[model samples]
Target: MPMLYLNTRHTLPMIGLRVQHNTVDTPITQPRYEQETQQARAGRGFTQPKITIDSYPSRHSYGYTNNTDFARENLERGMSEVQKGTSKHTQMAWALAEDGPKAGRQVGIEFAKRDMEQRVTRQRTLVAAAIPDPVIQVDPGQTHGAPIPAKTTPIWHTEGKAQITYHRGSFETYLQQKGDIHSWTSEGKYDIYA
Candidate 1:
């Protein structure tokens, strides 16, 4: 014979189960909740979220410096002013009054010449900074082989079917050995298996 258990508190006996009821509701108390809510509704207690963004050049990006561009623009602008006889140097030279027109033209031309020289120097400096000289290594005691002449034919023209097949095989082998293929399924789940 097996024993039976019953919960007699309910009208129907509940076997292998217990029932609990929470009739009283507890109120949550937050500090200044009503005051803050009222102030928010009145547009008095809220501030817009602050967002900041920063930008920087990528490590692999290749470009000239801002100073180079500025130098070029400044040179052009100064030359234009000189041509228009509106440059400060030209005006100052004309103020001397002894040979106003000739003095002004001479000063303006000198200023334009100096600006061109500075612009060229800046461009050269930038080029130097961007490209470095290659380093060569030599073994003095080792016997050297005959120099190989550079090939004139393009690599694609020289490559045969066997070479292309070999390259494909090598690439496939590399992918099988080291590649991790990830994909997304139609069910919106990520799959790691290829």
Candidate 2:
């Protein structure tokens, strides 16, 4: 082998590094609205419904995702309730109320109970997060571990409210007394077909 030992490392070809790209599918679903867009519900899109929030409330930092979900759900429920009165499909409800349902007082009471049930469920499910234990030890021989702090998550509860006035007066007097219905502006308030 004498002095014929050449540097074999110098004869080897250099193999460069390689990079790869991963396949990804990003699907975006556009919002669906019968007569408006997301921005409209946000209070500033296409014809800006006058019944927008008079003031924007501050959002919680710790409960961002949760609160956002709650807000969306709350809004959806409210919109659904409103749609019951506005949507043409539900217009039959009014007609049905006329001929099908008897004892308007009892029917109203049942509706109130159902509304209460929904409200109760909504309130209870508002705060949904499980706190994980940082350190769980069987023996207390070493104080290097901090017992899991039982986290008390803050809850944003809704009072579930609706403005109602039971009057012994006529419908005309009632409407006149209640200048604004649905919290619309004075100029925006209007009467519905009786």
Candidate 3:
């Protein structure tokens, strides 16, 4: 039996392979508006009706799977040359040619999976720092007669965002604002009542 002794220390340097990375993002949730209403007193008030505003915070999330086909192909191609007696390490290439591709592919997959996870975590941190909390503004305007039960609906316009970063790149962010008033009736002295 002829034993093959493969030395990777020199073969790898000669290959000079470059790593490639790609990212794809998909929105898991659709954008929509929701409202919740509550009743509160205008508070022993003078004239105008007052409103208390509450807003929901923006949210972010991500998911991914690692496919190392690219890494597998590159590694196999590079190692095959050695297996074909093209390199000094051909003697050792026999064993590696059998198991090297599988091991290399698994390593590549694990590395890519971990890398993607870290990227997602970092992106989430960046998004949290970038997006500001939602703001709700209400102008009670004027009221009349007596203080009536006011119906106030806190409105929130929420949407999912998918940010894809290629080779550790940056993403764009912006603020969204929404406002609305529903079902108000006026009788006498009190200015506004819901």
Candidate 3 lDDT (Cα, 0 to 1): 0.50
Give one digit per residue, the lDDT tens place, for model 2 in 44-154.
223322333321122232443466678897899999978875763354466457644664445445555766888788854466555432332343232233334333444
How does residue 57 of candidate 2 score in lDDT?
26
Write one digit per residue (lDDT tens) for candidate 1, span 1-194: 34333322213332342334334443443233121121112222433444433222321134434676668878999899788665655655654444546533565556567778877887543343444333434433433344444334322222222311111111111222333333333333333332
Order candidates by lDDT, high to low: 3, 2, 1
Q: TM-score: which is higher, 2 or 3?
A: 2
lDDT of 1: 0.43
In angstroms, what RMSD does candidate 3 have relative to the true structure?
66.4
Best by lDDT: 3
Compared with the true structure, model 2 gives a TM-score of 0.20
Error of 2 at 76 (Å): 7.3
lDDT of each: 0.43, 0.44, 0.50
Off by over 4 Å in 2: 1-92, 95-105, 121-123, 126-194
TM-score of model 1 (CA atoms): 0.17
